[model samples]
Target chain A: MSVTMDKPPVADGAPRPYTLRQPRLPRWTPPALALGAAAVAVGIGIGAGLGSRIQWGLIAGLLFVVGMYALAARVEGRRQAKDRLATSLVWVCFLLAVVPLISLVWETVARGSKVLDGGFLSHSMSGVLTIQPGGGVYHAIIGTLEQVGIATAISAPIGLLTAIYLVEYGRGRLAKAVTFFVDVMTGIPSIVAGLFILSFWIIMLDFGYSGFAGSMALSILMMPVVVRSTEEMLKLVPNELREASLALGVPKWRTILKVVLPTAIGGIATGVMLAVARIAGETAPIVLLVFGSQVINNNPFDGAQSSLPYYIYEQWAAGNEASYDRAWAAALVLIAFVMILNLVARGIARWKAPKTGR
Target chain B: MDITPATSAAPPPLSGAPAPAEQAKSATRPGDRIFLGFSRGSGILLLVIMAAIAAFLAVRAVNALSHNEGNFFTTFEWSANSTPPVFGIAVLAFGTVVSSLIAMLIAVPVAIGVALFVSHYAPRKLATPLSYVIDLLAAVPSIVYGLWGALFLVPHLGGLYSWLNDYLGWTGIFAYHDGAARSLFTIGILLAIMILPIVTSVSREVFLQTPRMNEEAALALGATRWEVIRMSVLPFGRSGVISASMLGLGRALGETMAVATVLSPSFLINTSLLDPGGGTFAQNIASSFKESGEIGKDALIASGLVLFVLTLLVNGAARMIIARRKEYTA
Candidate 1:
């Protein structure tokens, strides 16, 4: 090989005229490439078509893309095997993550649309039965709002204050201990929090099931999330502000209240909303503490009250098709609420982020 | 009112005169006293809430143990609704551990792979959209996951289950009787899917923050892309990987909806992963809490206490490891 390379170079000192023969195009490459591109185009066209027909398009598009890559590799050789493997794995991971999400949303919409009328949202399930399922989840919705409201009321202030302490005055052994325990609390199973509240309020204190106990349970779950997120947000605030506030002769607490918190208020609000969204979907704690009911209970301290999660559980677990429809509708409503909260938080955080130079 | 700097300055001089000589003599008074008082009081209150949660859980767990009719730890039978209410969380614990282990096994590698691809291999234009998709995955509620798992995944996994049973049944863990759609393996897979995006996003952010100079230096030294990641990226992100895994495990262990929807409950323990009756702690609590009698509820609470301890231990260990890493690096 070396001798041939040297001979060719020696003969072509002024650049050996390599013969540029009119090359015969390979039969397979063009057709295969064309077929792959056409397949992809047809897949996209079908996907854009109406209704259930779109699924075929999606499947076709996926297959076409794979086919295209495979054909390209066959023509190109095996040098890019690692890249191909990585690309395929990335898509596989994405599909694994996406299929369940799309399925869930699709199922929710398909089933919930049956019971998503004004009547379902407005009417209570007080009169509905297993045999006949015509009523709505109004009672459960109210219970969820009220219980979560109470939970937020209990958790937000304490969580924010504790975060303030951790960020501002966390210099000693006590702070270290608090930080450790908070981390531990952050990972407490929702069921355990429910159980703790159940044991304390119901078993230990002999109090009957109530929405208040549910709130307490939710607060336990919500507090650590709020504290951790708020602490993070607070830490992002610059120390210069604190120094400037102190230089102005402001008291430490007042400086924190005015300068530090306001600067991070947007992030704090987002964190709090995220925490609320988190606990709002919780089912276990409320199942143990609030105990689901059909009729709406106004008072947190009263008997069993329904929540959206518990309602979904009760309805779905009934095994009736109508009840299942109701459950799906309730889940849709719950998902809507959570998604809205997340969106609003994201919006606020984005809006409130400090303006920087372009 | 003339707000005079003169008055403020005068007061400081007088205060300073008394503070310099008297501060030495009465150092424990004034500002020091107030600061110490506020700090200690707030610190103690925070500590109390933390301690209270643990203390209350311990007390209730003890009460449950005393009232429990059977061996609390080892009994796989959950007959809490029986005449004597004989039960234990052994099955639940087993299911929890096994499912979480399986989820970790499946999710961590994929998550790290996704993270690496996004941080390094992906086109810059594609990174944002890819990340946004992953974030959306993280945002979908767990209940939606349950609904999806129950409706779509369970029905579709029948073929896969039969394949596993046929090929790997000798292992006992993958053994199946009649190849049912519902199994611990399905639950584990669902859990893995659910946690994948979370771990991926966190790990991606951490990997993106790895010092560019270090990565370039490795590449400049004739290292391949994979070698660069292995030598420069993974070591820098070991703590982050652990944290992400812990976070994913936290979600997995506490995940109620997906498990409850997928796994058929049985009290008896079986070595087969395809057994329809395996229960996790969260699943047990979610499924039984609604209709459970009073004693049954207590037993559920006791089981929840165990879950609580397990999560706390896992999270606490993660935090400790992270803190130690910070100390080591600093």
Candidate 2:
């Protein structure tokens, strides 16, 4: 009855109006038009003798954007059309950014699986030449694991203690200075980290190229990451827990050790794992310091060692089909390793989150 | 005696055990003192490492600069392995800045677009998963990006190269040389892609943090959705976007593997971006270090020092902007 009262005015002799007119564009219009524009783009690409898929994509994107804007302007008014245009542009930008990244991953997996297997995973490239087909990243994997493990070992205690200091005991100028420098260290290029180690350890101290040297640089890179994340986690732990623990007859150190660290352990672990993943894939420092070797050197302190990223770079630079395959396989392994670390870290974060009543 | 009448008024057992403990107590506990020492030592060690990085870099850089046969700042040639060791950072510095600028220019707008897509345009279900996927993309190693750029991107860009040169060739900057597709333009595109997730994620975070009350107020005034956003969200997030772009620039300036793999270097700077030759600092270091002698290594260290300072300044400025914004928001 209320809707009928607000109906358009009409004389008794005039024909009754049907349904009300809609002001918005149909919900399915954008996607349907996008598909049509893609067809048009492909057609024009073929007609105009453009051979690149990138060109085809670009043409399609432009067509879709223009087409959507024009159609929206016609059906809807100017204001709504402008809004639709902005929305369409945003969607298009997201798609344009996403497609290439997805393509990169697909290419890696599709090409990498051919050379990845148990045999590939277990063998070393020591006896194999660059032109041969029978070597794997086993040695590089060993080098990466040992180097990353050593870096984590060196960084975790220092990073953890530093976070504790900042969160619990920090007071004045020194804490602020530490915080500022940590920010700076976070932005240090990996190669610069390598250069630092190269200057102090290898050049001045007369040490040789070895996996240990790479670990030193990796630790420098890894420390700031660990400290930042751990500090964030420590900050998330509430003060009441500390107050309660101290209200007991417990010493302040014991309260931090027993209460604060326990409550934030899950997040701290996740942070450390993420830091490990980051340093694990670093190539610049390893290239500069570890100086990739074909042979598997188990002892990190003795001689040059191959790492996964360094291996990928070395194989790619070799400039041959066989070496390219090895590089792709190593890439696949590295991706898998990093992804696994990330997944486990996320899982731990979820599983161990402090319980609040639902 | 027993502190006179006060001890007698308290319980006998309570007062008996506490007297010795009170007499022996110091201002601070032993455990607390030891732990404080340990943590403070760790903090000092961090500062020492940072100071040492700067100190060592300076010493070596000075050593290399002193022995140079050519002007270290302006010479175009890099022949540190030669007898007199003639080398400089002129081309390297130019390539680093130009490529990174191009990267920031391209990546910033697209990233803002993508961020708006995730935060404002996409449905809730899609937005959550899309952000997760973007975060995953951020974790993909730079080496992987380099490999993909070398194998796939370089080949695919040839058509775009010809297209650009055909249309914009008169500008000289866009002119084609018909050589390897490896050029600074390609490096910029690769860097843009590498930094996209970082910028998008950051801007998305800021966009998501826009206050709901202001949004509702705009909507109550019969404003359209875009109008509400233009009135409130973008204004709120402008500094955040700037800081994010600076962060991306920092990454692009220091990026190593992708630039090295994608660009074929030459000593001379060509105005044509479609031509294949320019070198970034990180790339130059990575490529030249393998065969360098002692002095050559030191010269490369000097360049690394430059890259270090550049990134530090950019990051410091970004942090300053962010910190100031925090006070403004409060």
TM-scores of the models, in the order given: 0.84, 0.93
Chain B TM-score for all candidates, comma-separated: 0.85, 0.91
- The alpha-carbon deviation from the true structure for residue A224 of candidate 1, after best TM-score superposition, in angstroms, is 1.3
Highest lDDT: give the candidate number.
2
Give model 2's DockQ, 2 decimals. 0.66
Scoring only chain A, what TM-score does candidate 1 earn?
0.81
* Number of clashes recorded per candidate: 1, 0
- Tens digits of per-residue lDDT for model 1 on A1-358? 2353244335544554555321222556444644665576566555654223324334544564476457545533332323344555555455555665677778888877887988888888876786586999889989999999999998888888788878887787878888888777877777777877777788789999899999998988888888898898898888888999878876677778888889899999999998888888888787778878988778878899999888887776786778878888988898889888888987898888643323
Model 2, position A300, has a per-residue lDDT of 99
Q: Could you tell me which residue pairs clash in candidate 2?
A: none
Top DockQ: which candidate number? 2
Best candidate, TM-score: 2
lDDT string for model 2 (B191-219, tens) is: 99999999999999999999999989998
lDDT of 1: 0.77
